[model samples]
Each structure stands twice: as structure tokens, then as C-alpha cells.
Target chain A: MAANISEETLKVSYEQLSDLEKEFEENEVEIIRHQVALNKPLYEKREKILSELPGFWPLVLEQAPPDVDQYIQPSDSAVLLSSLKNLTVSHFEIDNGGKGDPRSIAIRLEFNENEYFEDAVLEKKLWHRRAKSGWTGLVSEPVPIRWKKPGKDLTQGLLDLVVKVWEEDKKRGPGAAPITKAKDYTPAQKELKKKIETVSMGGVSFFGWFGFRGFPISEEESRAATAKDRENRRLRAEGKAVPDDEDDEEDEDEDEDDDPYGLEIFPDGDELAIAISEDLWPSAIKYFTSAQETGDMSDIDFEDGMDEDDEDEEEEEEEAKGGKEPPAKKRKA
Target chain B: MAANISEETLKVSYEQLSDLEKEFEENEVEIIRHQVALNKPLYEKREKILSELPGFWPLVLEQAPPDVDQYIQPSDSAVLLSSLKNLTVSHFEIDNGGKGDPRSIAIRLEFNENEYFEDAVLEKKLWHRRAKSGWTGLVSEPVPIRWKKPGKDLTQGLLDLVVKVWEEDKKRGPGAAPITKAKDYTPAQKELKKKIETVSMGGVSFFGWFGFRGFPISEEESRAATAKDRENRRLRAEGKAVPDDEDDEEDEDEDEDDDPYGLEIFPDGDELAIAISEDLWPSAIKYFTSAQETGDMSDIDFEDGMDEDDEDEEEEEEEAKGGKEPPAKKRKA
Candidate 1:
């Protein structure tokens, strides 16, 4: 049947499939390469955070993932001085909570520790229930740490260590992907994004970025994970190291792998995805459509060196292409 | 650490965990039982729809899963008159898209065909662009439908068959889960749901319904899905179905299986989900939280038989129980 996704293109001609395929392959590698290069350090930080956060800041285990070691020990922070912005400490616990499995990090900062504390320890919990940008604090558990005396050298070591860790975290990691809530888009872009967000409020979901999309799995992943289900099934069949208790754990892993194609935004995307994307964001359609048409990415400026003069040519070419109905761009021989 | 997911009790009391567990176990079976009874016919329709829809609306193959047979002889519709509302046909296509491998169902409605036709097919694509109630349309391709002439006895039989199919579809089938765009929620419910929706817009997910909470996985389903995967894998191994071509499909299936509990709505719903749900839907929280406390579901009114008088008594009992923090409902023999 004739399909109309948007006014600009009533139907994607059958012939365009070849073009779309070519376009996808031509740029996917490079795009991924670029993303890899860009997100390499971030990914590393994410890994390190996964490893380090659980050991010291087990409360982070609630919001962030803990390595096997971290999970075993978990975080039991005695003095949790959160929201250190201008010394506005939120929650400080005497009996550090490290016992709970799969702990939740978000807690209403309580003032219960005031009675147990000495006169010198004046602590306040920051709710942050309405904290704006650049004001958000990390969920942490600095367990087993006695609040060091202000002048005590013992406290300095703890303070310095905490400082170093905090500085490292400030660099942005997985738990805080695109951290600090920095608005990267322009005002117009922000408005457009808001509109998109409003429109996409429905319970649309992508399962997880585990197997579907190559989301940089590390060596330290759980034994239940990393090992393929087939391998696990084989091990179980062989009567070797098949843990029954971790059935829930394996189920948890599958949950992460829920998304059909591991596509974060697009659901079951193909040419249909192209149509949706084109319809939703018509302005950006040219990049995908034109690229598909000319499987020759020779015209694509990955370097973005297209000058003003070339922009005019691009528009004229687009107009001429649009005039050719049913099929916009022909197969480049 | 103590997690306070509800205002009634800030932290999920340890004692309540037992009660909650009991409630979940007791009510879950019954809730699911109730659902089973209510949706028995719907489920049958769902099965029938899965079987028969592909025979006619194989275009649904793009959106729905293709049975093994559908992969062999796909739909080849010559004429498609879509809209039944005032014969306002939206997309009418002659050459249904079925040639491409692992085809994407997106089509372009040709204006040229309008002039060629006998002043009949004037179709308009419903983007649902402005027709909000949270809906939007995507263009699709349906092929291999044999066209029936307008006034032929043979066409009458075909039309009768189509009518029967449509009548079956009218009942809420699995494929057509609550069609016709009716508002299922009241305004207050909508507002509350929006709040819940807003709070739960993260990348959280659940996996297969296995052993976390009893998520209704009969022994039969596992065998079937596992066998299918094994068969599919075997086919690939034998070069009968090398599915590098459909990389996305496998992933999508995983996404569907993300929630370990497979709590269709709640993704990886632990305490975080509880907090969100409680904060958003306080009225619903009693069922979940109290369920866990008693491990006893005597309080649960699954039948909705508790009238206004019983509702008052329930409230009084709840209040009386509330005073006993950390120990709400005692286990009833």
C-alpha cells in the first residue's frame, strides 16, 4: 500500500532500499569510529567508576553498578558528607547502610545523626529535591569514615582522598553520562528538543545497551553475564558451576538486553525508522536520504569543510532531486 | 541503608519485607488469575489473529513477528483501500512492497495514481500529528492481498471473509491491544499517569519472568522459546538461515525480554520503581507495600467486593496497623 510518513516524501520508493543500505554502511563505521574516539575516555571512566565507586562509595551502588568485589563488600559509609557545594552537607549516617542488596541511592537526607555526633560535628542533609543545574550532588556512601576533626591530620588524609575521587568524578563518567546537566543545545535546539521530549512522553523504551548494541562490556562483568547464555546452558548441562540462586541475576541481565536491536531511540528501525525520522525531523532528512542515494560518500564531508558556496549547490541539487517523483536519487553506478 | 519508598513509612521496614513478599505471592497469582479469566477470550482472539492476520495483513509482518510460513510466501496485495471511515482511503498501493529481503514496511502514496484511478481512491495518511490522545501513525507496506472486484459474487465471498476477520479483530486481541484509540484513563488518572510516566523515563528494564517474583512463566513457554532460538541458531549454523541480515530482530526480542520480572510496565522495578510509583500513585501503593508486609493477602480485595462499609473498616485496620512501625501486619495463619 502507498505509505505517507510525512508531506515531504509520501512514500519511500522501493529502489531507495539499496540507497539506504549503502548510506548506512558507508557512514555507520565512521560514525561509530568517531563516537568511539570521542567517548573512549568517558567509557574508560565509566569502567573505572564501576570498579572504584562500589569499594568506597557503596551508596553509589544504588544508582551506579558495583563490581563483584564491591557487591560482596558494598558501601558502608559512617559519615556521608553530600552536597559539599559551599559546605552544605546533606546526609551523614553513623550506622552506614551497606547490607541491602541492589540498594537505592536516592534518600531524603535525615538529621538523625545530630544527637550521636559531638559538638564539633554540625551536619545537615541536602534534599536537592529541587536543585537546579550545576547544583546536583552525587549519591555517595563514605562508610566507616569517622568524621575527622577539622585540625586533625587523620581527617586530612580522608579529606584529600575524597577530594581526589571527587575531582576524578567531576571529569564525567558513566553514572553521570553528560554530567553537570550542561545544556549543550542552542536555545532553538533546546526548544526543539523539548518539543520532541513532550511528543515522545509515551512509554517508549529501548531495553538495554548490552548485547544488542556493543556497549563496551568489560572483563569484570558478572560470571552470569559475559558468558553467553548458550555457554551457561552448556555448563548447566555439563553439571558444572551452574548456580541456581543466581537465576534472578541472569534474569536481571536479560532485562538489560531487552531492546530488540539495541537501538536506544529507534524501535525496530529500518526503512520505517528512516520514514519516521524523516517525518519527525525533516530538516535532517537530507543527510540520510542523500547519502543513501549516492552510496558514494565521496560527496560527504566528514570534516564538515563545506563552505557557503557549496551550501547553495546542495540546496539546488536537493530541489532538482525532489522534482524527480517516486524516486528521488537514482542508483549511482 | 533504610529505603523509605512511601510517605506512610519512609523506609521499607525489614519486617514489612516479609509481609510484602507474602502479599505479592498471594495476590500476584490471583491478579494474574483474574487477568487470565478476563482475557481468556481476548487471548484466544490474539492466537487467532496471529494465525490469520498474516494471511491477510502480512504487512503487519514489519511490525509483528512473522511466522515461519509467512517468510516463505509473503503478501502480494494489488489493491489496498485502507480507511473504512467514509471510504476516506489514506494509502492505496498497487505494487505492494515484498521484493526486498527482511523488508521494511514503508510506502509512498503516489498522486499520479489518483488521476489514473476512477475517481475513487482519495486517501490521506493519518499522522495523528495533531489528533492527540497520544497517538501518531507510521507509514507501512502490505503486500500480496488478492484484489476483489466491486460487484462480483466471488468478491462477496471475499468480502464476507474480510468482514468476519474484522469482527474477530474488534474484540481486543493481543496483536490489536485496545484498538480504536479510546481513552482508557480518566483525567485525574491521566494526570497521575503522566507524573509516573515522567518520573520513569529512564533506561531501566526487566528481563524474562522467572524467579525474582512469580511472574507467571509456565514450564511450557521456556521450552518453546528456547527451542525456537536453538532451531533458529541451528538453521544459521547449517546456512539455512544465516541471520546476520536481521541483526536488529534478535536484539528487539531481547528488549522485549528485558524485565527479569517482565513486569510489562515497570522496568527493573526495585525500590526506585516503588518510590516512583508510590510518589505518583499513592492510592496504588497500599496494595504493593501492604502486600509485602503480612506475606498474607487477607487484606487484599481482589474481588472488589469490599463496599463502602468494608472500605472504612479496611482504612481503620490500616490505621491501627500503621502505629506499629517496622511491624505493620502480623502473619496470619
Candidate 2:
């Protein structure tokens, strides 16, 4: 019986083994099919590129270039012309007094040499028209010529224009131009243009005049204007017309009380107060008196009337009521 | 004559004064009209809010919960429980052969202790039902319980379920249920569930059976598989019948040399010659001689027959032509 049982067990295991083998064959075929499907196209492209490009290695082994140097510098003419070109006159003013050929006319020019020279020369016609109306010109002497540390040359066009202008001025008539002496003319024009151009490039306006002209009001001047305004306002508030400067300076210095009007009652009042302060005062006084009369001065003096004893009583009441005030009584108080 | 000139000057000045005054009055009126035209309503709601809010702040104040301290504690039970409540167990696997039960299942449950405990017990029942219907019966233990820390009492419902399962097992008597010991029930169930959950999370197949459940193939097993694959390929290439592992080891070793046809000769010639060490030269020569007549001595000794001087001359010619032979010549050489 044991031998029979073993034989029967062997037969059952053989049947199981056949079934597993068939399954494994089918699975392996499926796996191979999937792998070929994934890799075939990739392998085909790799093979094609490799087979077609045999000599690619030799072509990649070629030769190459070497190294060198370069830089820049400015010419002396450029330096000189650039400085002179910077001198300029921008606008002019004339106080003609309604007559006499605009006597004492003042001219304002930008202080850059290059731009000023261009305006005066190549663009000379622009200022010449203005000059025809009888304004003489004056320019500040050029400040010491300082080249920009890394000196870059002025443009060829500007340099050419400066030379042309100088030639034209010389041809016009001997000594007819303000710029005289060949040495003085070239270096001075060049230096002036360079300084003016450089300074103007630095964003400064150069202003000068042949006759009297107002600079920007200095701090002292602004203060003087303010003081004069204050004095004028004070005189007008007192119903007194401000006398001209010829008036006795001592009389003007009199104390505020000597004013003809009793405006001295509010000496501290300014133009704002003079116009509206008095009108508002009576209404203000009325409101104050009514507040005082009613003994409801909470708006004026919030804690003044409540005595220390009253405060103590309030605190005690709060403690008695569980650290809170009774709502209606608190409201009334 | 001087008096007449002075009178004329005075007359002209007077006329100019009247004209200037008229122009000034006109300008004053124009300026006033311009000022009135430019007046605009200045009030705006956004501006009012910007000015009136304390510190002129922009965003509205948000009053959040006052007890920020509550979030800082590490062992807050409610926080742990809430996080666990959101915990999701998405899939599971049962340990069974193909005939026992379905391999996979998914679960979603709230954190109620009673519900979690009921679900854990029911999972086994579900597997049993599938098993009775001709599917594999996979025995799985319950999942391990994780908490904020160990030694904390299991959730009330989980503890209750453990007690119930233990009581049921005792009532059923020995061998009636898969879970036998009351002491072992909880941990066994936990370990099974955790394994299934871990495999499911990683998105890998969960194959469970015998002692090898969850055991991955070792590196040695992978190398053996690769070797088997190579042997199969060799059989396919040589058009030989692939043998199973049942082949006698002695016969298989002898078969390595039994290349009945010379089909493998061309593809493997270089590699076989290199692999045959000096000690194996006699055997290699015998195999080669037996494979063919004369062995084509001309092709075998071709490199040896070329004279050294001729080879040098050819190399010099190649060097003269840029040290690069054309692709076809290089291949032939």
C-alpha cells in the first residue's frame, strides 16, 4: 500500500509539472514579443547612424587660431576743441525802460564750452538773430581746463564745426570777432568748449550776463523778501498803507501799539487772522460763556471739577458692584 | 531844449504806466479765473479711512483663536486622533495560493474605535467567504495599531474588538478558528494587515504563500536567472534542442564541445581562441584540425608572410597621406 501511494503521488506531480512548463513557455513568448516591440526601433536607428558615419572620427581632429591686443587714445585737437565748444550763452534780458535801444541788456548762456561754441558759431545764426536786437554779450572766463580722467574724444562733426567757425570769423574781418590772436583763439575756444561740454554733461547750467542780472535769490535775499512781506502785511492790517522806502526808517520801527487802528489788540495776528480772526471771536466768546454758565464744562475741563473725594467714592461704588459700575448711574455720571 | 526833452520823456513814461496797469489788471483777472477752474472736490472715502484708522493701518484686524499654546504640545491626544481619523488604508493583500482567495482588497474607514475594530474583524470573514466560493483562502492577521506613543491604551473600540475576538476563539474550542490563542490574536492580526497595507502603498504585487510571503529574490537568484537566459539564447542561436535542468551534469559539460555543425565558428572564433589558454592549446588545435581540411593555411599565416620592410614602406605612405587610410582600406588592412 505504501508503494502504491508513492507511485500515485509521483503521477500527480508529473501532471502538475507539465502544466507549469506549458504556462512558462507561453509567458516567455509573450515577454520576448513585448521586449522586441520596445527595443527594435531604438536598435535600428543606432545601427543606421553608426554604419553611415564611418569617417566622422577623422574629421573631428582638426586645427585652431592664436591671440592678440587692442586699445584707444584722444587727440590734442579733440581735447582743445572739446573744451572751447562747451562755452555758451542761453538767453538774454533787456530792461529798456520803454526806450533807448534796450540799454543795459543782460545775456544768459549755458556755461558748457562745446555746446556754447556750437551755439555761438556753427549754430551762430540762432543767437545772431537775437543779438541783432542790440544785446551785448559777456562770458565768464573759462575755469582751469581739466580733462575727464579717461579722456574720450569729441565727435568729428563737432571738431570740424569749431574749425569752420574760427575760419569764418577770421575771414569776416581782421579784429571784427571778439576772439582775436590765433593762439588765444584756438586754445581758448577749445578749452572753453571742453569745460562747458564736460560741466554741462555733468548737468549744470552756466549763466552769465553782460550787464546786471539776478542770480537765484540767495538765502539772505529770500529772508529779506519774507521780512518785507511781514512788514507790509502788518501795515495793511493796521489800515495804514505801507510808505515807500523813502519813509523815515525810524518811524516804521515804532512799537505795534502806535498803529492808528486798535489792531494792536491782536498784534500776533497774521494775514490769516486779520481777515477772519475778529469775526470769529464774538461767537467763540458766546460759546465759552454759555458753557461756563451751565456748569457743564466737560468740553473745556474734563477732570477739573471731580474732586479726589468724589473719585474715591466712585471707586468704592465700583467695588461694591462686583468691580463694575451700574450701567445707568455710570452713564449719568 | 533840455526842459522840452525832459517833458517829453515824462509824458512817454506816464503813458507807459497806464498801459502796464491795464495789462496787469487783465492778467490778475485771468489768474483768478484759472484758480477757480482748477478747484476740485478733495474728499474721498479711501483717504478718510487711511487718515482715521489707528496708526493709519490698511488691513482689517482679524481676531484668531487666543490659545496658540494649544498647538505647541507634542502629545495632544485630540490632535493625534484627528490625524489618525484622516488616515486612509487604501488596499490590502491576503496570503493565499491562487486557489484560496482573491489577492487584493481596499478599505476606507472612520476613526471611531468601534468601527475600526469591527472592520478589522470583518476583513477576515470577507476573505473566508471568497475562499468558500472556490477562491484561495488567504489567512491574514490584523494590522498593527500605531498611536501617538506605545503603551497608551488601544482605542476603546479596538480594545473591545480584541476582547470579543478572544472570547469567540475560546468558545469555538481548539482548531475551530484560525485565531487560537487569546494572547496571540491581536499581534498576529496586526502584522498581517500591516504587510498587506505596506505592499499596497508601494504599488507592488503582494504575493504571499508559505514562509516566503513578502520575501524578495536575493541577488544570487537574479544572477542565476541571467545565466539561464544566456543558456537559452545560446541554444536558440545554435539551432540545438534546449534541455531542462533534468539533464545529467556530466552530459551537459561534454555537450559544450559537441558543435555538430560549424555554424558557430565564424561569430565566436576570436572569443573562443582568446578564452583557450596556453594549457588548452593542444585541445584547441585538435578541434580546429578535425573541423576542416588543410585549415586554409594561407589566410591563417597571411600577417606572418608580410615582410617587415614592406610593412614599413606602407606605413610611411599612409603617414604621407595625412596618416589616415580611407575607411575601406583601413577595414581591409
Candidate 3:
């Protein structure tokens, strides 16, 4: 007979089990809660920065004309100048063309008081171009700018400082308060604005100018261009608007009537008799045969009599439906 | 005087420039085509495989009875039979127990003959259980069958072979074709059919006996059971179920609420508490307070008195708006 367990003993065992289970469940819940707590602040901070940056754009734009506006009013330029009035003036310089007229132009620029020495120096150089015009004006060159630190505020400070420097140079130059209508810009300012416009339009890498070029064209675009060129040539041959260039005359010599191989073009100008490089023919054959098997003949145009084997297979299939067996296979000699 | 260059020499240089440009463009187009050729086969293979796998489900389901469609089926005592047909046989066996004679049952199952060895073995075992009813009748544990090596036409070969095996087994056993009505089923045929259904339902695992014990109880059922237990206890305490046993009860401890932690019993008599560990509280509080100061309060429930500081700050802001200067240096001593 089984021994009877005491109620107190049973209760103690039950309490221990209950405690273990409770602890396990609480740990699970706490772990999830702790992970959420750890991640929530980071997620919120990222979201806040993203939202605030876009909001800051409007404030930045308030100090300058809209980028898309073709004409920048002198009043808009004045507003831009006023925004930078409290910035510290780093230096005052007048560019005297070596031709000996010191008073020919005098321009003064105030750098942001909080800007670093290197940034202030760069801003001073950038401002010097704002005083010239026409062929004699300075041309804009891509210069690398390094930040003093990594935070969003520091990056924004640098951008604001650059804009302030440009504003000061514009405001202090020449005859009128509204500088846009002043009828003349130092050739340098005009060139700088044009370069800025190009950068904004192309979004090309600055490194591209120094042997990097632009991002390579995508494969899809290249293929599309080739296909379009092929189609244009075809349409022109059929009397379309495509111009008759020398290449069109060359293409006519390579049209093949019964070429089993699917070469798009032949250098020898005789598609049927032209020999492919030994290395290329195997790949050509594989492509053609696979395409034929898959019924994807759009890439290759076969002559009527060239695909006799396909026709024979179709005829045999029809005969089989009529209760006739296909012909015996031919034996190889 | 500077010498004038000949038109022929200039034309030759111009032609060479045009040729170089044309060659560069052609090379770019060729590179694009080669890339497309490389990727095309992989895409085609992926597409082909994706289109083929979805067709296997219906074939798998065909071996089971069309109507026996529960993810889990329940039987008396929760003893799940290996197959739907076996369940039917068990039901018949239970129903016929009171009768003088055991009833004869026939089961038929169809399955893919070319499946792996484990699958065929499982199928055969499940079907055999219908006829055997208990563990004493089989020769050995069934092994899943697979197609022969170089598996061409193996599906048809296995189907024919299984039918032959069933016929031979029937011929060797007496009265194996047990039917009240006139019918023929060799013991092996009945066994094979049951196995097929089993294999279809459980695959190669053959773990039908455990029968999904870990499945969660439904919330509704749990709630109902708790309510029922509470009512029954209440009635018993009031001397409704048994009057004599009531006086035999020891002093009922109504001091249950005296436990300081307020632990509660769930319907299943499982206890839960929301108490924090005394050892961890100091560290938790320090971590939480530091997180709050750093704008990273992801853990604490600052839902009640914690917001009082924020309200006080708002009041100070309102006073400041009304031209009162904020107090400086209110650091705690």
C-alpha cells in the first residue's frame, strides 16, 4: 500500500513549485520589458532628430531666396544679410587687381563668431569670389570641408556660417541695398552661382571631377539604349524618321537569310559566310538552342526552311493524334 | 607665318575621334548584355522552383478521409489512434465489446508509392493497427519505403509492388477478409490501408500516441472551470452537498488576506504575486533615476506623483511668461 503524504508536506512542495513557476514567468516578462525600455529612448531620439531637421529647413530657407525662384530679390538678399548681423567678423579684405586700382572694389564679410579658424579661413576665401564678374571672375572649385565634430547641431552651424559669409559679401558690395538689381556682378559671383547650380542638378560626386567621373550607368539603362538604337535603325530602314547614318549602310550588308547561328551582328559584313571567333561560337550555339527549345525565338529570327526539325516534330505530334506512330529514329553511320 | 593644316589630315583625326567614341559606346553595351546573360538563368531557375513546390499539398492530403478534418481529434480517454480509419475501427471495437462477437473491419488507404522509406513504413504501420487493434499481431515495426536506385518510373513500380504484397499476405492468412457482409480483405490489405492513412496524417514521425498534449487550454474553458470550482466549494461550505462532513471541518482560516504581499490564487489554484526582490530594488531605483535624468526613462512607471515636478515646471513657465524672472540656482543641499 502507498504511504499517505501529510497535508503540510504537500503544501510545502506545492508552494515551492508555485514559486519557481512564478519566478520564471516574471523573469520572462521583465526581460521583454527591459529590452523595450532600452530601445525606446534610442528610437524616440532618432525619430525626433529626423522630424526636427526637416523643420529646421524652413528656418534656413527664411534667410535665403527659394532655390527654385529664378530671380532673387535684393530684399530677400537683405533679409539673408540681416540674419547674420550678429555673427563675429573674422577679417576685412579688399581684392586689388594687380592693375593698380585699389578702390575698384572693396568687399567685407563677417564670419560667424563661433566658427573655427579653418572654417573662417575657408569662408574668407569663398567670399573673395563674390566681388568679381564676367570672364575675369573666379570659378568655383570643389573644396572638401571637414566638420569640427559629429553632432547634427555642429553640421547645421557650419552650413549656416557658409550662407552668412555669402550674404555679407553680397550686402557690402556696390551701389544698391537690393543687390540682384545692381545690373552687374563680379564675374566671380556669377561663376560661383553657376557651379552651385550644376552641383544641385547633377548630384554628381565632387570626386568625379578628379578622375572619378560619375556613377557608371546602370545595366538596365545600357540595355535599354542598345535596344532603342536597334529599333530606331530598323524603323529608319522601313522609312521612319531615324536619320540615315553611315552605320545604317554598314548594317544592310550583314542581314542573313538562313544563319543557324544567332549572332546579332558580324564584323565581316556577311552574316551567313562570316566566321565567328572559335571562342564565341559555342556560347552562341548554346543560347540559340536553349531559346529554340523554350519557344523564346523573339531574340533570333529563323528563316522558314532553317527550323525543319521543329516542323517535323509538330507534324509527328499531329499524326500521333490520328493514331499513327512517329517515324523510326535514323541510325548514325 | 603659321602653317595651315591640310583638310585631309584634319578629317583623318576627326574620323579617328568618332571611331574611338563609337567603340567605347559599343563596349559599354556589350558589358550590359553579358551581365543580363549571367543573371537570366538564375532567375529562370528560381521561378521554375517556386512554381513547382505548391502542388505537393493536395497529393499529400488525398490519402486521408475527406471528412475527418480536425487538426486534432479527441477520443474517449484521449487515446488517439494512428489513423482516421484506425479511430473508426477503435470506435467500432468499443461499441462491439458488449456484443458476443468481435466485428470485422475493412479500411482502404491510397498513398504516393514513391515516397521515402520512413513515410511508407509509417503508412503501413498505421493501416495495420486497424486490423491488429493491439500490439500483439505485427511481424515487426514498419519501415518507410523509398523508390529503387535510378528512380525513373519508380512511382508506378512501387504502386504495383504494394498491391502484390497485399495479395500475397491475404493468401497466407485465414479469415483475414473479415466482413459481416460478403467481402474480401486479406489481413495485409487491411493493414496496408491503415498504414497509408497514418502516414498521410502523421508523416514519418509516427508519434500519434502523444497526441498534442501541450496544446493550450482555451481561455473560455479555463474561465468556466474556475467558476464551477468556486460555486461547488461555496455550496460544500454551506453544508449543501454533505451536512455531516461540515461539522468535521477544522477551523477555516479566514486569515488568508493577512499575507502582506496580496498574492492571488488563479482558477487552477496557481498563485501569483507582484512583489519585487528586496536585493534588486536599490540597483533598479538607481538605474531608473539615472535613465530619467538622461532623458532615457524607458523602465519606470512615472505615472503618478512623478508628474508633479513637470506640473511645477509648467507653473514656473507661466509665471515667467507674465514677466516674472525664474529663480536661479535652486540646487538641493
Task: Considering chain A alone, report the TM-score of candidate 3 relative to the true chain A.
Answer: 0.17
Docking class of 1: incorrect
Worst 10 residues of 1 chain A by lDDT: A205-214
TM-score of 1: 0.17
The runs of at least 3 residues in candidate 1 whose Cα sits more than 4 Å from the true structure, single-residue gaps closed, are A1-217, A222-224, A233-333, B1-146, B150-333
Mark the 10 consecutive residues where model 1 chain B has the least summed lDDT.
Answer: B127-136
| Candidate with maximal TM-score | 1
Which order, best to worst by TM-score? 1, 3, 2
Clashing residue pairs in all predictions, respectively, total 46, 47, 19
Clashes of 3: 19
Over B1-333, each residue of candidate 1 has an lDDT whose tens digit, in order, gives: 321123333122322322232232233333323322343343243334223222212222111111111212121122321311111111112113222111111122222222112323222211111011111112111111222333322122222332333344345453442221214433433343344344335421111100011122222433344345445545643657444535345434543323222112222212222222112111111232232233235665422344334533454344322221111111100
Candidate 3, residue A281: the lDDT equals: 19
Better of 1 and 2 by DockQ: 1
Worst 10 residues of 3 chain A by lDDT: A130-139
By summed lDDT, which 10 consecutive residues of candidate 2 chain A come out lowest? A62-71
Model 2 segments more than 4 A misplaced: A1-333, B1-7, B42-333
* Docking quality class, candidate 3: incorrect
Going through the candidates in order, their DockQ values are: 0.01, 0.01, 0.01
